[model samples]
Target: MFRSSALLSLLLLAIGGYATPVVREPSPVKLPFAVRFNNGTNGALNIIEADRARINLIKEQGAALAEKHENVHKRASYSVSVTNEAVTYIASIGVGSPATSYDLIIDTGSSNTWVGAGKSYVKTSTSSSTGKSVSVSYGSGSFSGTEYTDTVTISSNLVITKQSIGVASRSSGFSGVDGILGIGPTVLTEGTLSGSSTTEIPTVTDNLYSQGTISTAAVGVYFAPTTVEETTNGELTFGGADTSKYTGTLSYVSLTSTSPAKYYWGINQSIKYGSTSILSSTAGIVDTGTTLIYIATDAYNKYKSATGATLDSATGLLRITTSQYNSLSNLVFTIGSKTYTLTPNAQIWPRSLNSYIGGSSSYVYLVVNDIGSNTGSGLDFIDGYTFLERFYTVYDTTNSRFGIATTAQTTATTN
Candidate 1:
């Protein structure tokens, strides 16, 4: 009787195998994002101040990481929606079995996915504590909490099972958002969790690829210039690039070998204000978290002089007259033999939303700012979203390279 039952079980297993055919690989996913403005401590809007603070924190973090010995260590067809919060890009992600959607900042600077800054995390059947504590400081804000692994639902087609997430018990600096969805290099996750200093946490992109949700371990980012304070003008594509979003072929550049900058999605690039060079080829990073473009202090001084732009005390950005604006030269960036230009209109902040950043709508403000430090810092320039809005970017981890291409908005005079 035991032998007969075993034969029957084997037969049923064979039948089940035949019944379920091979599952097809997932396709690239695209996530739409919007723009929002977070009010300051005084209940007024001041994006420049907030952005500068964040930049300072990022520089400090990079420098500290460099001091420490380096030990650290998807493609789908569907896309998730994200928001461009004037200063920060946000995405709504669902967690747990009975998913509770939380608004998270889409950051390419850090790699520790967490929640519970603005909304408390809700535990469900799929939530399990990892018995480890996690904490991260973002210069302007921070959070400390217990680590938990749960089902993270980025979208219907982009779900990740047993993903590690920090449930913040205490957090500050993120008043409007719940937490950050870190999509930077996995190495950035090192030392953020307790009990294991060397163990790096897998980011959302990591899990998505490992779990067979996407074929490639890459993310393509597209951002349209925003003239309003709030609008959906960005997209995050997982697994692969959306070829339709870009024009011409995508140019690739290997990650920089320089330290600190190498710790993130670092690259080598030079800046030229029209025919004149400002910042020579230097190691830096491409960050989605930053609101404006930042170059070395020396480079900024040169740019200021060339554009005839004066620092505006009111907005803390370079102010130019209509005549200067008309004569404003294209800010050209050369990365990996490819030249990307930010036209005069693209260099200035959105005139329509000038008041939102505490600037007079009548006056023009340039988006390029000083990095507070000169070159040779290993991390000299930061091509922020302002630069990205005009190009299509691909963060290809499997290739250890970054890709860029011109887009329809590359020369748009929208701003």
Candidate 2:
């Protein structure tokens, strides 16, 4: 039932709560995430190379979606901790009654939730097969299986009943994780299910609101920069934004009208290296599935020239000298009327983990890379994990806007 997006530029959860006499306003549900680098089935740990490959696949997913025209449509106070996999965020989700917890990738790029890439699905009394086949192709990974509805548990305060999920009969590219928790737009689910070409599946967030488990259909994501290989430094807040996690007020921008980029959690932004405008106001996406900040090839070239960095053949990242690192300019992104800046220290990869990506300990590496294409592609840039680590983000589906604000680590020299 699953076909590769390469064949199609194409294609592509919930929880509940209890009652109280106090009648307090529903609080946002929170989930924690940690970062871990996948070693691949061959036991290799080249994160930079792996991330570059993933970027290509994500672009492919966007391109496929751009080719098709679609209408865009748009939580609780529970907290779950997640691990920050260096290249991906991992969260444990429980499925079925008497839930069996499975480690899943918390991805906002793709929207069809599935399992069985690693752990087998455990059917419970609440499980029901929809009799329809389901499949989704993530450029780096894919799964083809049957569609089923069951109870999905996010936290004690957050649970969704009769939520749809894919039970994978076959999968690939997802190692060390059970499957994905897609938080992207529900329209992306079109064509992912048999006999449902025009039907759009309700995402975990959508069901949460419809079921009255949360007051708002939104998710606030927070990630802090870390130097270690693995850490519990990220959280997913369902229902609404967590004010305490961010410093200033949240500023939201409407989703861009541009194609492909607009298909996901996309926005319009411009980038500057200090005072030089590298990327003009353009459309792109803010993706949790991507590891680094990627811009158009020409913009990347300008950045490389400005920073005096060379391509590191071993890691596929821009390499620079210590002196150049000290002289680096702040990479500023102007979204709407607000500006978010990445300090010079925030531009480099964590030096402590240099060896993990096949780089020398003494060499300095920049996290910015080329998107492998030019600016007019619609999806000309990707503000990935590196950028997310410095800001608080809100995917406000109910309002059809993306929100960003300063965080405690916005100017941290952690890297």
Candidate 3:
């Protein structure tokens, strides 16, 4: 079972909780090896060097544009704090005046940091969500906030120069989440907030780069999951890769528009535990947003029966017998010519419930924790953490395929 509320609170503020004090540079931690993946069809592996070069190209482009304004490629890490169930701001972004902290989510799956608002939402022009009063909801809940354009600063590191951010009244039900910080390329863009009305908005990336915070057009993000542990064991370094966070090499799987973003490797024909095949499916999404691996019903049942675990309805989590949990061998998923093996913790997640049950075959609900008590579709799933922990995913949406590589692999140039 998991810890109590005290532990949970501590965990939230541990790594991903409060934005840490801003650092002047990306973490110098170097992982054990380079991360890359096979293209899945020809058995050609796409290493990190070339892909990194491309990503670097984009960063350089951003930086070049920034140099014209005497901008420096300054990046830092800041702690995000939730006060009174609401996030408070500490850094100041200098717009036409001083920029105040607003609520925001630091997301890697997304590429932009935007606030919800429009021209009419704010009485002042220095709002991320200005003139824009909208009700936005996530898988978590809903919040009402205005969007305005302002400068957002983290630890003296400028985020957006004149970016749009969402400013909400203390009454919004965000339950502590401030704004959405997207790290994906296309996912980040300027837009209008929608509710009863709409208004124009700018992304933090656009705002910051346009201003003089960092010289690069793109910013990097380092994030650790919100768990009940306060270890600096996890971090996402923007503009550079930190090598020490993981033991093995980094692997990659591409992201696509499909359900489970595509990987460089093909659908794992089937997963294997020694000689037995566990589950076979052609769909899976490599999401940085999720923390667990969700397998379909067929896969979930196979794992349950083979692992001899039981499902608890109260918590909607699966529990394997202590002996069963420890005795399980490594499980592997074969995608094209590549095979991914997972550790025990990667397969079986810790539960927070004391007791209750059905058989283990029913506990595959992936989203909303235990949100699948009465639904059938929820039983088949996998969260992103389990897989990402085992493999470095290379998302190549441009080519319609993703890549997967073992932690021992390194990124190399193809040509």
TM-score of each: 0.89, 0.88, 0.54
Tens-digit lDDT track of model 3 for 386-407: 3554444443333434445444
Off by over 4 Å in 2: 1-24, 28-32, 40-44, 70-86
Of 2 and 3, the candidate ranking higher by lDDT: 2
**Which scores greater on lDDT, model 1 or model 3?**
1
> By the lDDT metric, which is better: model 1 or model 2?
1
lDDT of each: 0.80, 0.79, 0.36
* Best-matching candidate per lDDT: 1
Those runs of model 3 whose alpha carbons end farther than 4 Å from true positions after fitting are 1-99, 102-104, 109-130, 169-173, 184-192, 195-233, 244-249, 257-275, 334-337, 350-382, 386-415
How many clashes would you count in candidate 3? 88
Q: Order of all candidates by lDDT, from best down to worst? A: 1, 2, 3
Instruction: Kindly give the stretch of ten consecutive residues in candidate 1 with the minimal lDDT sum.
Output: 1-10
lDDT of 2 by residue, 1-415 (tens): 1111100000003233455332226554445466766553244355555556556665655555555555322101112122222376777789999998888887888787888989999999999999999998665667899999999987767788999999999987786789988888988898899985668899988887777666678888888898977777887777777778899789999999987787789899999999999999999999888888999999999999999999999888899989889899999999999999999988999898788777888789999999878999787899998899999999988989999999999999988
lDDT of 1 by residue, 184-280 (tens): 9998888899987678999998887776666667888888887866667777778777777899999999999997789889999999999999999
- How does model 3 fare in lDDT? 0.36
Candidate 1 global CA lDDT score: 0.80
